[model samples]
Target: MLALRARRLFDGQEMRHDQVVIVKDGRIADVTADVATDVPAAVDLGDATLLPGLIDCHVHLAFDAGHDVVAMLEPPGLPDRMRQAARQHLAAGVTTVRDLGDRDYLALGLGLGLDGPEVLSAGPPITTPGGHCWFLGGEAAGEQGVRKAVRERAARGVHVIKMMVTGGEMTPGTHSHLLQYGLAELKAAADEAHAHGLPITGHVHCAQGIAHVLDAGFDSIEHCSFFTEDSYAVDHTVVAQLAAADVVVSLTVGVAPSPVPLPPRIQQRMAGMREALRAIQAAGVDFVIGTDAGIGPPKPHGVLPYGAEMLVENGYAPLDVLRAITSAAARVCRVGERKGRIAPGFDADLLAVAGDPLSDITALRRPLAVYRMGSRATGRVGQINQTAPTIG
Candidate 1:
């Protein structure tokens, strides 16, 4: 049992002041207003705000965030690197992450310790021959082949099914604007995934591909950026349709402050991407932070917090950005009941920042303490403990 008292607390949806969160085992027992207490065991986080540890809806543990991502995922010691990546996320206060792409079902095999973030694994994304991310060995084609692929993931105990509806910049000979699978094949994959009672997300970069994912009844859409051959375009009609549909958009946002230039295709169209995102938000479309971490040099595994921060920088309200990363993200990843909120019966994964994050979002970058499963996993306390959390 543990009693954690903080000056302020963001309960994943709202803010509260002077609260004490009681934890038993690995779940939050209760939360109440702080008062004079004889309970001497409380860990008082002075002048700090506690919130639920964040969740990232999409990430790729297989690909190390580097210039040569394809070359990085070679067979030797891949699992160890993935474990380190998962811990890096946990150390940075990300308690949950959905691995959307990986090679050879390796993400599921990594035994990230209890101190590590909970990983929702998608073994390998289903893609067409030579399609987006075809190098991960998830290439499939035709209705029958896609269905078989879905079944294979289900049998392997994957948490969700990922399909590449359009080509992506990562794969050679594949354009971000082109659709890889036809409607029939997409529907077949979605249907098969649903039959196994799994939610499926589509990796789509073009406007038409987003519509196709919605029409095929997929649970969510990834990278719905409406990219074209040369520049990007945001179709208002499609954005409105997505708003009306029972689907969520896993917006891949954020980049590390690096001198490296982004891929040519993305760099050219980067100016218009923010406008497209705002248009989607203006249409009342639901959103969750994906970050597409580990795909390149700018998207390291623990960079999800920067995604929320970037949204705020790009005109999104700070509160909304916080919600998108916490509660909304958990909902998209299908872990809403257990993760995100710091309420009773929820997982006791919490992050404590030195200052109120609601006021200064960058405070998240300076975590004072991170608790996983009701125990303090790591913390930085004054000049005595300035060490960053090491990979567990």
Candidate 2:
């Protein structure tokens, strides 16, 4: 048994000051305003904040954080690179990550104590033949093909099925805003995944793609970048439908400043992205914070917190941003009850920050310690050499 005392405790939403949290057998035993009796030991982390471990719902563990990740995927040494990437994410306070796309079950093996970050993997993203992300080798042309792909991934023990309903800019020779899969194919894929007791996540960026995702009953939509001209009108009817279906929207923010210049029209369209985010928040649609790490300018590993910080800068309260990364993200990733909170019976995965994160979000960047499964997985202590000759 261990007791961790912090200056502030973020128990999901509210931040309580001077809280003492008790841990036993890798689970939070109790959290109280007053220290509990019969505690075996206590570690007083003075002037630090305690928060649930952060979660990044969308990350490509197999891709290196580089400008040419798409090109790098073709190399023979991709597996080794992925393992290193996973470790980087763990060291940076990201205890959980949902791998949206990867080759084979590389991430699955990593999740099962093979490497780092309790990974929830989509073995391969479903895509039309030669469609977006087809380079990763998940190509399904018709309904039967889509069903077969989902089953194959399910048989391989994938936690979710990721499908590309629209094209993206990152992939060469593919239009960013084009819709790829039709309704029939998408419906078949979703049905097949549901039958196997797996949720489906779709990469949809355009208005049409969003509509199709809602109509086909996808569990979540990745990068719902609905670009518009005047008022940023994203089909609210579809947004309402998603809410009714309890579908989550994994919004990627703080992608880092892009060096490439966008055309005037597309720049205008990109401005609407935030409006769409606010609209989703107003509509009460479930939103999770997922930085598309390993893509564009956002470096992999430690970049997730930057995305969370962006949420706060864009009008979301600090607690709301925390929820987006914790409870909300876990719920979308289908691991809600197990992780994401510092409550009883939840995993001891947590981060200890040096300052109050509730007031200043940047404190999250420097985690004094990280605990995984009730163990001090990562941290250090400095000792001064008192015996050494003193310079007066």
Candidate 3:
């Protein structure tokens, strides 16, 4: 058992000041403001904030954070690159990451502690024949192909199923952001995945594709860029449907690499992504933060803190942005009860930052300590018999 006293605590939603949190058997035993109780050890951390370990909803554990990601995936080096990427994610203070696309179930094994990041992975993205991300070699054709693909992935113990409903900007030689999967085929994929007890996440960009994703009963939509020739507007009806169906939207807002050269019109559409997010938030759409970390330039997994900062810049409160990375993300990933909050029976995955992240988002970039499952996993405080830095 261990007791930790912090200047502030972000318990998934709100911030509590001068609180004491008890941990036992890798779960939060109790959190209170009263007197500190008896425990094996009590660590007093003054002037710092304790928060639930962050979760990155969309990451590619196989890609290095660099330009020319496609070239990096060529051949003969994918396996080693995947392992290095997972380790970087863990060292960067992300305790959990959802790998949207990978070569195989390598990310899944890493999540099971074979490597790192508590990975939840879709073995391979389900795409149309020669559709977006065909380079990863997950191209399904008819309904039979889609069914077979889902069964094979489920048998491989994938945590989720990813489908590319439209082409994306990052993928070369693809069609415009429109429906790639027909209604019948998409419905069949969803039905098959659900039958195997797996949720599906669709990669959608344009308005029509987004509508189809909603109609096909996908568990979530990635990107949902909502681009049009004239303006950007989420079909409120589709938003309403997604809300009604309890479907989530993994808004990949800041997933793109910064300042990439692009046409003016594409840049304009990219600029409007935040407005779309605001609209979705206003409509009470269930959403989570995902940095499409692997596809874009400077692609590395576990860059979610940057995305979280973008959420605040886009009009979310600081605490809400934190939840977007913590509870909200876990909820979208369907690991809510186990991985989100800092309460009893929850995993003891936690992070301590130097200052109150509610005041300044950049504080998240520097984690003083990272604890996974009731053990001190990483960070340097001090050796025995010496007090650590108060603000670390």
Instruction: Rank candidates, lDDT, best first.
Output: 1, 2, 3
Flag clash pairs in model 3. 65-299, 66-299, 111-119
Model 2: what TM-score? Answer: 0.88
Q: What is the lDDT of every predicted structure here?
A: 0.85, 0.77, 0.75
| True-structure RMSD, every candidate | 3.7, 7.0, 6.1
Task: Write down the TM-score of every candidate.
Answer: 0.94, 0.88, 0.88
Candidate number with the higher TM-score (1 or 3) = 1
* Per-residue lDDT of candidate 1, residues 114-192 (tens digit): 7578999988899988788888899898999999999999999999999999888888898889899988999999999
- Where in model 3 is the C-alpha error above 4 Å? 34-38, 111-115, 229-237, 240-244, 255-266, 379-392
Worst 10 residues of 2 by lDDT: 381-390
Give Cα distance to truth, residue 45, candidate 2, Å. 1.6
**Model 3: how far residue 187 lies from native, Å:** 1.0
Query: Which residue ranges in model 1 land beyond 4 Å of their true spot?
Result: 35-40, 379-392
For this target, which candidate reaches the highest lDDT against the unseen true structure? 1
Judge candidate 1 against the unseen true structure and give its global Cα lDDT, from 0 to 1.
Answer: 0.85
